[model samples]
Target: MMNALAKQSTVLDLIDEYDRKAAGVEDAIKAYDDACTAIEMAGTIMGTYVNPVLRGKAYVHAREMQKNLLSSGWKAIYSRLNIDMIASARDKKLFERTLADPPPLTFENAKATFGPYLENPRSHILRGLAETFAALDPAYKSHSKVKIGVKGLPKRVILSSFGDYSGTYGRDKLRDIVNALASYRGQPLMEHVEFNAISVAHRRGDDAILDGRVYVAPERYGKADEYQTLDRGLTIRLFGNGNAHVFFAPETLKDINRALAEFYGEVLPDAEEEGAKPRTGTAVSKDLQFYWSPQDVIDRALEFAGIIDLKEWRNNSPEPSRILEPSCGDGRIMDGIRARGHRAFGIEYHAGRAAEARAKGHSVLKANFLDCPAKPEYDLVVMNPPFYGRHYVKHIRHALQFLKPGGTLVSILPATAHYDHGELKGEWRDLPVGSFAEAGTNVPTGLLKIRTPSPSTQRATSW
Candidate 1:
């Protein structure tokens, strides 16, 4: 009886596996049919309805304005402006009254909706501030002399020079410069530890050696970098070893810290934790690997724009392929994709980047890719994913899930990822060093090309 039960379990597992394979085949057929139908419909509409309509009177004035209104801030303004009531300027008294006593400025008002900066707190402003801070190795983990007090309001800064690289200014002058800058901003200077003038041999190298780092906050304090107005205070000066130093005022620091904490919430570790390792350049690279996909790289990935080789998706192939970029920074990769006559949709997490992408006329969703829900409807998925530890590997795994059964996933990633995901097999080629010059780092990178399993087969187990 026990042996019979074990056999029954084995049979059930096989049956479940078979059911999954069968579903994949059905999905493949549906995707193919859908693709062919969409392409035909799009072509017909573009050639017959769209081109003629755009040149016609109906589209030239009214429809064009309606369309332009939805592009950016115009939509918000148009909605709240009460166009119907304000359209006629014939009655000066009625117009004045309407303008002066407009409907209670609702949340729909652009000014009311987006603060003075025209940026939302949650999606735009706050996220940007947090991203800036998060890019820095936590203050506690930094090898730099300054320590940030994150636990309270008006975060305190502690300064201590450990190495003897105070360049020509010397350690004493370094401290004085920092103190003077703080005073200029009307902030107090706290405990200044005695600078230990270590000899060149005794001093170990540091990662944070100042390289003229400038922290700009003109909004909170007047231009700190100007030499004439703030001559008494030093805005730019060499720290030990000629490392340049620039800092923000206490109020500015408090505001930034608050935003960072709010954006991170429980996910960010406490900033005060001792023994936390500083984020190295490599670590930071992983988070902001927004390197644009080189045209040569794009050419190679698509097999010279040959994307329809997979047997499963042959039926519904788009004339100019449909492409999805999960982290399309400034839409560079998308630009290349579109240049090839393909339709590209992008997801950019940074508000600024998303805006730039929109300005370039590419459709982009300004939201975290992980948070956005996607359909397995694209013929290709392309990206240069962030390499924060397992992040690149995970992104590849996620991208695979969004592809039509036999769609392709192309990405530029650290070579280390080749070994991370054993189950998902792909072809990889080494990209030259310094391929990411815009990102400010040169690490061994590779182009990984992965094709999803054909519908006729079971899912890739490793993915």
Candidate 2:
């Protein structure tokens, strides 16, 4: 009986001490609230004063005092609770919910509720505080309004700012959409458009500004696609993060929508009756013979070889040189070469394509490039060979034999070809995804630029 009475007495003493401490905590909280109110009132009065110098000095002093108070108070609270001052988004949300209608303010309850936050606090506490403030204060809640115009975009093209929407189209459909647009616009649209990653910020009064860099192509084509910058006319910006922005002249909006809708299915509400139908083309075959390199891609390959510059080649007088394209189908690469005032020679196995090249005033041999003699005569050899299986490797290796010592060979091959060709030494650049969409293939491709070793360098290595 005596031991039990002693235990009861100890419990009573603890309860008493707890009550007293709780009372002290309440009083301190009230004092802090009063101090904050007093500081705010003083600052407001100082702002109204006519003397700018005195007001400025007072503001500085008050800000410093407030900062010190907040820092000290937060530190004390964190130390007392044995909890971190920071919290992750999930933990912060949990904290907010717990604080909204908290249980009796007890240590056990706090520990139970914020156990996860105490374990890991990855984000700053100020963000949670700002959110809380925004909830309570109208001024804090006020944000700049953002309006994105999407009526000019295709109906199938989804728009998202805060990542709330999943797109309706898959990558293949998206590529087809871009290809359709390119056909309608009668130019390479992939190089001019941006796709599959975007960030938006508020500009002034209902306007949102999007800022992002050009999408560099990946090594192997995945479900994601990338678009480049278009300087003239319409600019379409699409992000992989499900954000999209389309900027165009008011007059061009109709044409732009029509172009996108050609492959995206549904036309805009205000589209004309002569709306575009979905593009139909020959499907990609296993042989990969139908893949025609886009002019932009061909130009990029030539540029990689230093044979021509897309920007200045037309303006500057051409330095006549011999460039070769093996298995050049329809003379697309040859056309790019001749446009730069270089003599373009092609070896084509297809009689029709060879005839077409000849029709374009290009000197093309109507024979198999592999069967042709390997002569170190050309200054540059630029070609897009067959991509089926390991045929590209064979073509690239054979093409090297035609390069003069110190001559560069630029070829477009499968993205994985670089890895496959362990014996060949070259620099590889990934072409953008959907680069060959208009060419009847979506296989990811890359540019390989390799230079034949000069005779002196070869001799030194041989020694």
Candidate 3:
């Protein structure tokens, strides 16, 4: 009975194989029929007289184009997948066996090769298609060069009208052709010999069109199908069998590069390296609520608080010579405080930022200010707290405890900080919208000068 079961299983497997082969043959016939229909339609539109034999030849040529397109598409798509996926034993073997192979560009082939992965409906061919698309430009309008195979017996190229409802018909066709030809070359061809003919259609209007003529069309025009839409002088299409066409405009090329990068999961290096780096002067840490106070603002706040006479501090030492600035990112405010003939201490939350402050010869405590023990020894307290909701209130209330009796506190806080929090009160002056621009924020801020009352004035002025 076991032997009979084994024999029956083998027979069933053979039957399944037979059915698969039969289905493949049926699919091939259908693909040929479709190719014939496409060739006939193209010839009819172009007014090319193709007899039955010529039609057969055209069918072969069209199939080659299709093959090239699909091959390029697959190559692009596979190249962008994560290394783990590509390096799997199964995929590795597939890749090794097909190194010089441009898989035949056909629906039947795609179905056979990719059916398992495509079982999930989310599988797509856009990236591979974009690679093929990028290959069509004779000048290779790409920052990074990719070789496209172009092994073919074609001095003259075929021009097929891509009439479809899809908005990306031109881009899709170009990718198809590029991939097809690239695969044919066997070796990668970074530069491509120009196409025989290229034609594209876009909408025309002098109206308020936001996306340009290529993207927008009328109600009657199903997107990308109107061939004559190019006749309105809105588009430039390639024509005749030539090795030279034109490169895309800067903006168009930019958009293409951006799209390709997204498809390939790549981030292009910034062309202008200078512009890419953050401007250190204006950079601030929002998480730590560290904002760099400008020298002018520092001077104004100190003078307004009546802690340091500007003329006296600049010329001689002030009465109370010690200053504290908690959350001193980069220590710009601390630097200003020291320049005014006063000793300054800073507590920076970020170690990296604290190091920067220390490098500039400032005393930086690399710890969160809230966690630090307050000595109440400092004569002045200055802080720019993070205004993420009501964080400024928490920081300000804590900072006040660090100043001694009759000591002054100067803070550059958000406008809302004054009205919402009544923990500490003093003379307040509203600053401009971009007053803290050096700190990398444009939130409107106010300068507050609050002084803890002396023993004598404590009773006169209620707490």
Candidate 4:
């Protein structure tokens, strides 16, 4: 009885194996039939037998019971996975094992591979694409050496269309692509390439209608799709070669050497040598005071409190004269203070600029406010931070902590900072100077000041 039971169990397992094999064959046949019918109806009958042949081949291999159980489903699963591994694989022979090129990395390919950015018109979808005269240059330049510099081993490139409602689409993707390009070249760096958006102008009467808003009929009337697309407001802009210039942070440039090798096969000997050094350089510097803009919040404090006159504001304190200039740019204000014969000190975050300021033989702290050591802190603080972006705010908050209780803080901030957080309050009124202006395309010249009274001193001086 026991021997019979064991035999029965083996037979049942064998039956299950045949069941799976039959099901696979049926499903494959159904799919092949559907594909063939569609192709034949469309009058494309040339490759119709290919899928059916593959289906028959799979069934033939699975005819045996042992093979069915051991190999069924698993080969299909593995072959599907092998598709991706083959495409990304460095080995050329891997394709035979995979049997196919992998599917495109669409934003909706899978939960892991697909991302939400694909839906956004502004998102940079195509990253690390090789720049071509056909793609980038309207007319191909035979030997144009003007390559967009990518720093690292770049793998993909992201491109965005100006037809976006919200403009925040491709910024992060652009950043990632730049970094990938740096990494692809066997190095680790990337350079940002910003392109300005533009609308082709139509000559209307004497004035050129620069804005491409007016979508007329007949030219687009027959095509409803084109009409909707053209009619719906779209900004004609994308990244690369544009009117709006963007700045890259230092970390962004660090990946450029790697990108160069990956994108262009040529081995850039200089990039390899440059990347090897411990202290690397980047491509960014504050444009010298040619068009220096003041921070309105800081400027307002200075204005409200009245300018601390150059004659009276000078602190000639003999007791180890101390002052702080956070985000000090080329030590302009600090130099002015020195010219007034006041022993002033400062802190600058940029290394190149800091060195420039320090070479003047004044004690300029060559450290970031956030990262600087607290020892021998400042008694007075001053700065003109980046107004276009909020990176300066982080430094501002850091500088505030460095000040002594009665320490003076002088700064120039954009007026936008006022309305941004006026209701929320703390440390804002530390100075009482204020100034404002509307047309700040050049220097706003608006200044403001605020002062926090020290309990130690009964006397008051204009900030």
TM-scores, each model vs. reference: 0.36, 0.40, 0.36, 0.30
Of 2 and 3, the candidate ahead on lDDT is: 2
By summed lDDT, the worst window of 10 consecutive residues in model 2 runs over: 264-273
- Model 1 residue 454 distance off true place after TM-score fit, in angstroms: 2.0
Candidate 2, residues 356-462, lDDT tens digits: the string is 98998989898877788898998889988776555667788899999889989998876546644345568988675446656655445678899999999999999
Per-residue error (Å), model 2, residue 408? 0.6
lDDT by residue for model 1 (239-334), tens: 454444434454555555544443332211111222234344431333333455666665665563354333345566546667899878788878
Ranking of candidates on TM-score, top first? 2, 3, 1, 4
Query: Which stretches of model 3 miss by more than 4 angstroms?
Result: 1-290, 307-320, 419-423, 458-463
lDDT of each: 0.48, 0.54, 0.50, 0.38
Which stretches of model 1 miss by more than 4 angstroms? 1-289, 304-318, 419-423, 458-463
RMSD (Cα, Å) for all candidates, in order, is: 28.8, 27.9, 24.9, 25.5
TM-score of 4: 0.30
Candidate 4 lDDT at 220 equals 45
Candidate order (lDDT): 2, 3, 1, 4
Could you give candidate 4's per-residue lDDT for residues 312-362 as a string of tens digits?
554663443366676665676666556544556766666777787788877
